[model samples]
Target: MKMIKTSMLTSVIFSFLWVSGGTALAEEPNLEAESAILVDAETGKIIYDDEIDVILPPASMTKIMTEYLVNEAVKSGKIAWDDEVKISDTVRELSLETNLSNVPLRQDETYTVKELYEAMAIYSANGATIALAEHVAGSEGEFVKLMNEKAKEIGMENYKFVNSTGLNNKSMDGQHPKGTKADEENMMSARATATLAYHLLKEYPETLETTSIRAKTFKEGTEDYIDMQNWNWMLPGSVFAYEGVDGLKTGYTDMAGNAFTGTAERDGMRFISVVMRTDSREARFKETAKLLDYGFDTFTYEKVIEKGESVKGKKALPVSKGKEDAVTVAAGHTLSVLVEKDQKEKMTPVVTLNKKYFNEDGELIAPLKKGQAVGLITIENDKDDEYLQEEMRENVKVPLVIQEDVEKAGWFSLSLRSIGGFFGEMWSGAASFVKELF
Candidate 1:
């Protein structure tokens, strides 16, 4: 392994402008939502945040988790999109509740998984979400367990789900499942909500097909055919439509207020924005647009290293006892960093070898295998004078691995190499002593 640091010029003009109050260094949009977050969908980098850590009721947004689990079950072959789902008494009762968002599921009728999914995604139907959950897990209680487990798996640390439909049990008018408390509702932070969206899109990108729909007819050509319209106004053709806004989920309740998790893509860059507890329905979409625009306008993804590419100055690593004297090394994977658009050219890379891989003599041990991680290559922007500080710098790290295998040398070869290494050390020490005398 080797260490290499590249120096680059900083954006002095921008720094001067910021210091002189010409413009703030980090200019963020003022959002009206109680809590909101915007994250890079591919990299999970936070572009803008306000009260993102505060936990609040997520309302219909809880369906996102239900949607995720249903997709997971379908992908894992536990269920199929065309599989028929029997509506239960509970689901039928939920559909009859005029106060809840539903598609009027019939107890005697059955629908395909895809139809139910469309209802949940497009209309935020509470009954449809519950039906899908019950079909996948056999019971809403069991499905709620799966939702919490999946949330933890997706890095949602501040989420709690009492029901799959995101409805407050009090609103159920005593029809809620047994053991569900009246005050129970899903609660999650804006940051966790954004994290969930990131994982959902990364794992199951096909969900965009459903979330992007502006309007569709479920169970078409049948007596039960119902017109479903997307609740997310940020989609194309909506009153507040924004270009590139395709997905995700929208939520509202008297208690939870209006909330939405929106995703959009432009020029190969995709972002997820979550707005929770906004004063009105339009505020959520408006604030989300501000977040998305801020991200795309300010930052861009920069590829720092390509997979299978060797780190500069790290062509080969010394081997103590092997078939050959040294073995080549290279980066194990591609590394990219999200930086301010103006700071792209100012980004620098620093590579450092892990000290454990080397001996006291600074030689790599023998018997190294290909793809073994021996060091790390970090990429950072030099625009900030405080680049050394981890908190203030935007950087990414990729593993540096041995590119080829180095087999152990025979006893005879090892002895010969040891002798040569001993003399080399002695000669280096003698030369240093002579230099000091001079």
Candidate 2:
């Protein structure tokens, strides 16, 4: 299969971006905020934000990252869900001293790794979280290292972790010998939270299945026989509760107020919203629902190209040493352009084929491969010409190739054909020469 030249491929892709528009959404006015952000989960576009870089304590919301690490390790076979873990003396005492969230583990009691994870994810159990951290990395401090590494990998620039649970006190350093102030246990900005949330949703789906549930009972053997409920109070689907909302976590502390990371999907589009330091749980719920509503109402998903659809305006490829005369190529994936409601009518996609397609004689040429991109399908705004020099945007390429192998005739047959072809060329050349002389 012949590879398409780089210049040709480059020309094709750049031409596709110009096809759309709207009154660009107004940028946010400069202002201080505790932290807030909205992002398109699929495209990773920041829709709105404030104070994204200002790191603040994430409270229990810190558990989101903890759960993410656990899920990834399990999925990668670094750890098994059913692997049993023995609780350390430190973990047992802390669970008693603090009225923190937990599944009520006894000293030295063992439970499968999966059970501990379920408690942490579903109940936001701080004790369960620390236990899992210890089990995975042999110490909470090391697990914090892995957490920071993961944060960097996910593009979180202004984040850090001091402990497995997010409840670290700014004064207490986790490394201090007992009774020390927890030193800013976990620090994250609204932007980082949204970024991490988006990555988790796109990369691992099983997490949502557990987070979305309202309640789950601990398996029969793990210490306390109590069933724990999710702390995310907005789940009931009330007035401010968004429709189609599912699979997320909630956080709150006296210092952080109500912090929530939420997700909702509708009409094939998904959005992630984070609100921090809201006045009350009710207010946090109300604002999250409103943000999701604004996103859905203002935009819609537009399918720009259907899979296997023929590229418009692209030239068909001339064949080389193939059975078929020429091959037709089309878009590999359904290319969709998302835009505001009113801009749909103004968009138009134009397809262009290569001009230097066939050889001098109108016969198929050699060595074509199917699925090779011969030309691109472009999209352009009809109105863009009014303001811009080039009114074209290319979207996707249509490929052309040999439909079937075109073998050269056998030696004897080719010899006969060559004589005829030679005679034809001679006669044509002589005619041209005579005309020129006259």
Clashes of each: 0, 31
| Predicted structure 1, TM vs. truth | 0.86
lDDT per residue as tens, model 2, 1-438: 236687777566555543442244533433233677777676665556766667877788888888888888888888889998878776666555445676777864667888888888778877678888888888887888888899876667677777777765542224322322454556788877887887788788678777777777886754466687876655554345567677587787777778889888887888888888877877777677666776787767676666676645533444543444455556655656555666666555555545565466644454554554444554564232211011112222233322333454456765666798899999999999999999
Best by TM-score: 1
True-structure RMSD for candidate 2: 11.7
Off by over 4 Å in 1: 1-26, 352-356, 380-395, 421-438
User: Which segments of candidate 2 are over 4 A away from where they belong?
Assistant: 1-33, 169-182, 219-223, 237-240, 315-326, 346-366, 373-438
CA lDDT for candidate 2: 0.67
What tens-digit string does per-residue lDDT give for candidate 1 at 332-421? 888777777766565666678899989887678988989999988776443333211233233367788998888889999888888998
